[model samples]
Target: MPIAHIHVLAGHPRPVLKQLLREASAAFAQALDAPPERLQVWITEVDPELYAIAGEPADEVLARTPRAQAEIPLIRMALMEGRSTETLHRVMAALSATTARVLGGDPQRVRVQIDHVHPDRWAIGGVPASQARAAELARRAAGQGG
Candidate 1:
């Protein structure tokens, strides 16, 4: 399974946020070669007063700069380790483009961090993924042919 957490400043329209979730899930599914039903993408909205940049609150920063220019979104992705570097790069580009297109910001302003966890370190239903998802993992390794 792959999970993505996108952090953005609060106050964006609900429709935009919903679009982000839907599009981001599609991006991850296509780039990571995972089933869309198995992927999770969520948004975390933060208050401007609680977020800071360059020692100033985001609320103050946006007051001086246009919201579109100043808003920066942080995305964190967690997945099982073992994907090729090419796949990782592709997912990053896909996510950046998706964020920029949906949120009306520069793609460069989007930050993505991917954490590849060992299967043994991840759990499903209280069982280590390595043990619980062995057949699924094998199918994935075999070009998703199963």
Candidate 2:
């Protein structure tokens, strides 16, 4: 299964996130050769205070720049459980291309982060773990989360 974990700031509206998510899932499904249902994607929409862009303060950057109106701090992570690193890169490339247009921003600005996690180490709908670590993908695992 290819799991894609996405963490985005709450600055954008719901629809944009939805678009990116759908595209991301499709990207993973195609790249990893996994079924849509088997491809797991977890999205964490954090408050602006909780997210940062390129190491810049979220609120400050948003407040000072007009890009904030159309641009959001986005972090996309793809996990290739039982897959190859080459496949993960291809997935990220597709995700960035589709997501930038979906979110209405320069495609170059979107950031992609991919990491691996264990099924037992992740949790959702409950305090499975700290938010910091809750956003990783695992291989050879059941569904704890993405």
lDDT of each: 0.90, 0.63
Q: Best candidate per lDDT, number?
A: 1
Against the correct fold, how does model 2 do in TM-score?
A: 0.64
lDDT of 2 by residue, 49-75 (tens): 655666876766778876535355355
All candidates: TM-score: 0.94, 0.64
- Give me candidate 1's TM-score against the actual structure: 0.94
Count of backbone clashes, every candidate in sequence: 0, 2
Query: What is candidate 1's local distance difference test score?
Result: 0.90
Off by over 4 Å in 2: 53-56, 68-82, 117-146
lDDT of 1 by residue, 1-146 (tens): 78999999998999999999999999989988787998999999999999997789999998898877888899999978878789899999999999989999999999999999999999999999999989988986876732
